[model samples]
Target: MSAASRAGSLPANLQGLWADGLNPPWSADYHININIQMNYWPAEVTALSELHDPFFRYIERLLPHAERTAKKAYGCRGAVAHYTTNPWGHTALDGRIVYGLWPDGLAWSALHFWERFDYTRNLGFLRDRAFPILKACAAFTLDYLVKHPRTGKLVSGPSNSPENTYIAPSGERGWIVMGAAMSQSMAFAILSRCEQAAALLGVEPELRARCREAIANLQRLEIGSDGRLKEWPEEFPEAEPGHRHISHLFGLHPGYEIDVDETPALAAAARKALDHRLAHGGGHTGWSAAWITLFWARLGEGERAWQFFEKLLRDSTESNLFDTHPSGGGPIFQIDGNFGGTAALAEMLLQSHAGRLRFLPALPKAWPSGRVRNLRARGGAGVDIEWKDGQAVSATLRPETTGTHRLIAPQGQRIARIEANGKSVAWKDEGVRLARGVVYRIAFQPAG
Candidate 1:
């Protein structure tokens, strides 16, 4: 997926020569709910930054169709995509409201631009290309939101939690509801990215202010009565206790809002939700298992993360390391699991989602010696690390731009010395201010 995406020649789903029969399932279209998005999870982080171009190009091609979808279907401004789209940028619905009514698709797509900006810090790209798409999506989010009658909070309505259903308090099963946490979280992310873009570009003050105001009115994620993060705004019983899609945890992974340090309660609720899902039969599919691995890494649980990683490799992978989904009879191929697992492994080695470049946050004991190069991080940094006995022996960080970066060294490791291009330097607990194109090396030993 990374190589093909980098070449800009990969299909939305890479069936290659393996595609069977005339009527392949789903017509080989990009399923935006999670599949297409999952395929690119490793691109930027693994330093295949150029791979994002094809996706952005696809988004650009789809914008006009998406705009029509938004205006015609919801009477709202901006763009919208259904569950699936072909290479030609078709944006029509799939006829099933359960997965079809998800307007969050474009909002979620906008996040790729945000992720690219996070990795590159290329203000020109953010201003000229990424911000326009994000701002348009934010406009859609603003226009698409309806006031919840009970709480008056801005909410999205008549949307399912992306292929999942719930039972209401009135004993009726429904796929449509107001404020599926996935949509809310995606909107929040879009708006947050727009605000940040505006700040970086030093333009669009009105848009930034509007985003701030709308953010205030957006629905808040709440822990359900079951001690888990609610999939929908209300405490509805899950139609499938072990549903494969962990949509409610959107804010926890891929999205930036929920953090263990900042929102411990929500973090705990996310963990509980995962436990609930796993206690049933969730994470059975390859992509879902990959997502679970990512969640565990985000929670800083290396052992649990490694366990799931192993599970994905064992049960959900083909001989070529491509991911496979479980059919009633046997395994079926899916590209998302492969890409998502790639991202998950990178996360286990190094994480930057919490606004800090954390080294070896979830390095598993199984991988005692390894080296990774050219993993991108937020704040315009590139990282390369080598570890032995699960301990970071040395790591090099290159700053593409000059800034003070909050650096989190490997847990339980003490820095024996730090140097910038061989010159000894003082490392501050707050952060290290770096110059453009300069490399900082840290020599560390295990903590006693």
Candidate 2:
């Protein structure tokens, strides 16, 4: 993969060229809105953490150029990137208004750094590499958002939900608008991570405080009148109701703002939105299908998630396994579907996003008997689980750093017994305190 990718273009190329052409469709540029980010989706989940080095190197090279672009384009401090960028770090602001004005590109890319740190738990990397990028993303976000005069919410404006358009109440079509849920959600994610990263370092109290304040002012996601999370804070009808991009779901999957446990109402609304989209012919693209799979997994709907995965395998791939995007009159390959599907599959087997290691939270019935090993969890834990007949039978956990962490059974399924280092341990909602280098084994009671 590395050799082939490097062969395509120097200075690292996320969008690898399948065939040689100077003027390929979409210019073969790194699409930051989703494609470029999706290319690396499976890095940590598939245990390909080292493969992400190229992407980080690309970002490192792009940062200085992005800083200049931010100041020149938006008159904002810190770094920013438009929807499309090239290997030379040239930020493109073409005539297409829908794709041109997005500043959330950097915020989305910065997630890779945070995700890498989550899997590795390298304090040096978090403190030195990831935190700086996250801080800059937050800085740019802070500078970019303006107070919405009516609502007083810190919001980004004149930004379209990536590649999506809507119809105004005045019966006019609009692509660019204010406070798109995607932008606000991305801002919340970046700023929230900045707060977490800063609190971890403990040396940037002022920065941390500002991030906290910004977070407080950021617009909270609101559901529309139709029982769906609004694409924009203002209720506008989608120009393409079946649009494949699930940008509004940023908070549900990649971002942690909305969850099934804490934000159950919003989570339900998101599920309804997904149902509506699917009913209206959404999830047509491979990447969109993969995201819906992840969303279902996050919602613990294994059957639904697996159904999407099956569709992806059946409809969205070439013989060689490259994802095929069937837009622009014919099928063109996009690697994001492949990577995103792999990550979603992992999410179905195990989820650690909410500071808890959940076993088979969304295990599909078709995968009743299977095993997964060496999956990384937050707080530096290595997890391996075996299940049979749709129930987790046995599991093992090893933590790189000693700490107390929650280990939850699948939703309502209870852990009949848990043993740590060959001794019985009590289960608490707050979780158990674990020591470094200790191997904990868990066993579940047989199903009736």
The digit string of per-residue lDDT tens for model 1 on 1-448 reads: 5545645564447342255677665666688888889988888898888877888888877889888888988888888887788877778666688788887777788789889988888888898889988988988888888898889999876677999988877887789988999888887899888998999889989999999998999997889887899898877778899999999999999987788878999999999999999999999989999999999999989999999999999988888887787777677776788889999999999898766778888898899999999898888888999999888999898989888777777779877877987799786777778888988898888778
Distance from true position, residue 137, model 2, in Å?
A: 1.1
lDDT of 1 at 43: 83
Q: After superposition, how far is residue 301 of candidate 1 from its true place, in Å?
A: 0.5
Error of 2 at 309 (Å): 0.3
Best-matching candidate per lDDT: 1
**Model 2, backbone clash pairs (residues 3+ apart or across chains), number:** 0
- Model 2: what TM-score? 0.95
In model 1, pairs of residues that clash are none
Model 1 steric clash total: 0
lDDT of 2 by residue, 344-400 (tens): 998998888877778898988899798999887777778899988788888888888
TM-score of each: 0.96, 0.95
Candidate models: Cα lDDT each? 0.85, 0.83
Clashing pairs in 2: none
How high a TM-score does candidate 1 get? 0.96
